[model samples]
Target: MLDHLIGRPSDNWKRTQIILTLLASTYLLFNGRTYKLPRSLVVTNRILKQYAPWRIALGTWLLLYLTKHTDILLGLDAPDPLRRMYKRSYFRGTWVLTALDAGFFTAMSIKPAWLRHLLSVVFSFYYLVFADAAEDKTRRVRASITVEHMRTSWEKAASNPILSFFSSLMRPSMTLKKVIKVKRPESSERAQLPPVQVHLYYAGNLDDLPDQTSLLLHFPGGGFVSMPPPCHEDAIARWAVQTGNLICSVNYGKSPEYPYPWAVEECYDLYCKIVESNGKVLGYRGDKPLKIALVGDSAGGNLVTAVTLKILTHNQNLLTSSVSSSFVMTSSDTSASIHESQAIPLPAGLIAIYPCLNFDLSCWMSPSQISLMRAESTTSLNGKSISHLLESKDHMRHQSPLSVEPDLERKSLWRRAFGLEANHAKRGTSLEERIKFMPPSMTDLKGANTSMLPSAGFVPRLAMTSRMSFFNDRIIPPGLMRAMAILYLGPHSYPDFDTDYLLSPIVAPSSLLAQFPKLYMMCGEKDPFVDDTVIFAGRIRKAKRENSRKSHHPEGDSESVTVRIMEGMSHAFLQMIPFLPDGDRATKAIGRWAQQILSSDDDTKTSMTKSKSLSNVAAIVTNEKDMIYRRRMGLVDGLYAGINEDSS
Candidate 1:
């Protein structure tokens, strides 16, 4: 069986090698045109800019063939850092992902739905095996945040050894570690949701914790269906080390099982428990006050924002002497006690990374949506000169001699040959297509004028691009996103929008937003959620401005809202940290933001920084020369400039 699984190479393999050589040379030749350097210098500085789909597809396929299908590249005789650029490990992983992506796109109906169901099964199994193997070697944590309260029938079943046995078989690596477990809530009478488990990570020994350690509640992104992978553990552990904080990552209930409101309820309950007990739930025995921040990415981002809104709504009702029935307390006694205090304390800040703020993703795009989508391209300028392609005179004087291009016409040709030509051809065919959705509930958001949320039967635009468009993003493609939405929201979609902020936090009223603590959001320029994040930030900024004016609060009195857009990045890039340079940069930025917020005095009349217009916002880019090799090997290198990060 082993011999059969790893088959012998044939003439077809040789033919494939020849074809790959020709294609790789073509890519190298294209890169060559950008510089008038000697032929001996094959590898140059301008390698990361290569963006051909064909090249990426082939590179991934060839990598799989060399590494998995055959042992050709695994032998001792195999070239070290083949071509003096691609590191063995990075090269192997990049290509395998590329091949997997190609398969996933096809399976998800990038071409057609003919074999989608069959391919889905095959790809699912393949992906699970690969993920399990990867996690097997990666470092894992032993600390756990066991749920002592809140239980459901599903949770009881999940804890059954017979049921868990099958689950373990499916995920051997994960099960073997026993890194997580769901326990029955001590008081089953108050159970409203499934069992919730959180994972704790600290830089130092738990016994040696600081006097006043900060707490960061994290939600790892998996489109609301999957659990937090091992990769998140490493990042969170690093964050805890850097900030000296106790980080508890939530293992919220998944979709098609627990779905929409369940995850939000779990998160809110866990948060209340932490705050109400003053971090005792997570084993914190510090003498000083506990400062907390909520951080999440993608689906997790949605959860954090929703929980924050839920807290605001709860506080608002408490002030009005009519606690909303939608808000549920961990217990009847706790609920009664909180009514006197009138509010649960808010977190120091919120850090949302590429969150899907809106669930009412319709088939049609609003005029604003289309405009935002088109804003990234220079091609949309209609006969406008591409003068921005050239560096400023001052920049050119300082640039290296080898990097400079003196000939104007040659420079133009080189730029276009690289990627500018494709950007100019707007009329070229795109994979974007119309997708009808269930009627969106307008009630989900209330009392907010200028809400970014779209309602049912909105006026359709003449030339609208679909929200789920290949031109917009490839990492979280249209089909996968649609599947996730349907699974999480159900077939008819979320019906109770007014109370269900988890469905789409973008629709939350500006009044609620104004009361929100300092919010720090980050997303990739190429992310599908970029438009939603930008719109949400704008709404928050506007609300805070109005509230400050009305209350006559000074400029520094209100907390700042910061938005960071990573150039040339896609959704969920957080998982790539310590691998891609940009990932490390993003992680470092998160640590900095957390420290700043946690250390600052809320009553202080000083503000960190004010947000500027989106146009003027500075974006985070990776311009380091050392990253060229990683970029050339298909690693994320922020080369494209679109929307910028804003700090207010």
Candidate 2:
């Protein structure tokens, strides 16, 4: 009779049992109230008020039932008729018991003032238990799409309240402005292009330089973020005068605001425009052009090389039709893969400084770690390991460069221009059809078109020569680089290019050296990045030799490439020049290197040669005066400061 009454599979039966049990628990709890209990036993009354017998029983039963029927609870199996009936009974019992516990607790707490005091203790204990369970469930549901909606709603509301307050307080702080001071060169020796508000500085006049020579395109390093400001004008102006070249320093858009492809495309667009406008003014007429090189430092170095590759792959018409030189990129990061390649570009000419690269969410610390961090030290955030976040299989693929396939047609064009057939070249087109359909390999072309494509076997043999080759490069590591290389070199693979193409060469000052005529690299003995630079120099030297052998061109033997290692200098010494005494050995060494690169008489030196000196010079010493001015102008202030000032 008891089993039939209690275990019946009826909804009303379950609800009735829950109500009866709740009433019995309430009566038992109050019955002891009339008899004064000891202080030690007082907690029992509070516990009883917080959790009635019915609630405890119902919760336990539900937990057990879910555990026993885990497959159906987890939606892993079809539910049997009996199981369905049991689940309904369990839900009804749990809901009724929970309502009773909540209602009774609320009512008792609202009654006598003494009861409220006792009930507060009971509620506190229950609150903790409930919070713990809620937190666990929240974590599991964090990845669910539904949670994102809730988060968005909360964020929107939170941001609104602070927005007006911040807006008012930010207005007065916006008075700072980045000043651009123009100091004309000693003479109008360097031609100055009309200032386009965007032009950072003017270097006198351009007409003074010889006609039909090389055009130097300079891209300064600021990690695709900050700029060197007007103080760099002295150095850049000196460079233009000394080299007798038309120099244009690009201030490309920077990231989090202008991220990824935006800066890259802007640089490429600017480059194309410069070549088109200046190629003729510089005296290169018709399809045959004069020497044009690209130069960049640090992040600019990455941009320069990536742009060069893009032009070579996508803008073949510009190369085949015009006369162009090599490229030079200095002290730049070349690792482009998402995984190992996230290493940020070191400051121009400073190897000790590492780039901040990873952007994974999991790289963030867990709640427990956060708590520990808060308790220990505020700076603990810097030491958190992103490796754990990057260890997931999904992250490995997402961060990898080879994960995405290149467009087939674009790949074919690039492969054909480079005089190398992709492994999958024959998959889509037959031999006869390929020969007939595809443009003739650049190897078979003459004159300007000879260098239209990169050297044969260049991509394939890259890893064999330098340990830092795509595969073995220390910053990149061998496994990831090799995997990417295989994918890029494979046939019909989608846009399988290396991210290194986005970084500057380890040896050169700028990626532009590949396109420019004269290029130089200066490394410090104590600098950690020195080894990679040495390896890079060796690779370029070998490539030059191979190209010379293939072409039999005496022009290839010129001193268009130079690599210098300064003794006793360290990374970021360039920025410390003002602090160093007049006779400081490091400062003198940097000045000397700067003078040598800027004053070199190698006519064959490409315009890109300026990158080595520009970056190295910038790193060796930054002008304190300029920094102060920048601060006064508030250009260096936090992000919103400038915006506030502008709005006001």
Candidate 3:
């Protein structure tokens, strides 16, 4: 029965070779421990192993046979051409015999039931190796023909009948509903509208409220690309509820689809609509004015600042008529030149998180500063002159808020060199040229009615009235502050309009500080932006001095700007969950500050007390904790002893 199952043998030598091959293959299969290698190499070796078993079996048989019968093979290796052919034939025959032996042993290792199935699967793969070993020209030709026929048959079946049948059966199912039912709620508890394209989470009543009511406008930040719907929604909602303020969360248009100017326009449009419809009852109850505030994070901060600037610029009449109260802007980067206007008092209290103010300057220029200048010159000039200008201009003006003097000089030179004087510079030269040469001067600017611009001379008085908060992190490093100062005072003249340009020390805190009467600058001790904030605070104080000395306005007073450094806080600590282990300390502080500002009739005294108290307390607490921790750890003892010994 075993003989019948194995079938007939081809020849004596072939049969003997197959037996020996089986023994060798069995030994290797059971005993060999395949070496492991790198992942890529392991895959390559596995493929090689599949062919190796057959090669080894055939090689062993041929070498043994040749060694046993060397004389007969050597006699046949006499004539040059014939001897070479014989050697090739002998090698080919040996490899073929080895492959068959390998396959026989492989079959023997499998269980009887699986043996037939396994052989069928492995036969085609084995045959490919065997065919390559064929020596006779006729045998090689026949093997190639066989392989081609098998491949063609496989292609036909794979392409048509069997494959097609399975594909048809496996096709995905699609069904359509013919009817739909709408359910209505029995009570007023049902959601009136299904989830829509934009979700707005609002707080506070949209109707008339008491005299102490306030309104918060929240704009989410996603670099003008997407909404920070999930992250900011809860905080904004909670703030509105806790403060008893109405919150209008705007879902502004995004980009690169919408682009810059359009998205900004959309924000302004939404704000206008809200004011038009709900302005009267926004922050106040009686005939008195309502206090409206704007708050946002990251890009949302940018939008808030831009909107506030717009309100001050284009819609002052409406703002002034509706409310004699001040507004608040938080975590914003809308000013075109943060450095220049760092000390400018905002209309209301201004608070900034890790604001990206001066940071945009880097993107506006290259390391050499030449590329940025070239880009600017090319973009500014019209006709065929643009291409020529980019190549010709060696000293490129870098756009930075810090370098006011150099920028002014560059602008003067550009106008004179390009023959761009107001008299000669042609109208409709190119949109680029027109924008370049056009002085930012608006004679009767929409928002500039002299009284509207925050009084430049109102330094000390303004500082007393305004509240500002600045938060930063350790990533902004100290050396970066000095680098920024150099850039600000460097030869490159940065434009005050392009807010996207990167500047040193990240954003310019001074620009905003100088304009607003109330200023609050806070940063984490470990934060990189800390050093910059410190330097900025010093600059603000200096500016306050200059303003006091130069101003003729009675409102001017000379007092140093206020600053705070929060312990263990990061860039956007307020947005963080729990805010602190003690429970959102920053938020509570902000709330208290807001309440005080709203209630206080004397802005100067109110702001002065608040700023001084916060700063002094923060410093004392930080110092005491450091001392206590060091003493507990025994670090203070050794240091104190060493100091005493050195003094003795």
RMSD to the true structure for each prediction, in A, is: 23.4, 27.3, 32.5
Give the alpha carbon lDDT tens digit for every residue of 499-541 in model 3: 4322222233334334434433444432333333444444445
Q: Considering only N, C-alpha and C atoms within 3 Å, which residue pairs clash in candidate 1?
A: 444-497, 444-498, 610-647, 610-648, 611-647, 611-648
Arranged by lDDT, best first: 1, 3, 2
Off by over 4 Å in 1: 1-96, 100-194, 322-342, 363-466, 469-472, 491-500, 556-559, 604-648
Worst 10 residues of 3 by lDDT: 460-469
- Residue 33 lDDT in candidate 3: 57
Q: Write the per-residue lDDT of candidate 2 for residues 152-196, one digit (tens) a residue.
A: 221221122332243334222211122322222222222252222
Best by lDDT: 1
Scored against the true structure, residue 576 in model 3 reaches a CA lDDT of 36
Q: Could you tell me how far off, in angstroms, the CA of residue 413 lies in candidate 2 after the best superposition?
A: 67
Best by TM-score: 1
Which rank order by TM-score, best down to worst? 1, 3, 2
CA lDDT scores, all candidates in order: 0.54, 0.37, 0.38
What value does the lDDT take at residue 262 in candidate 1? 75
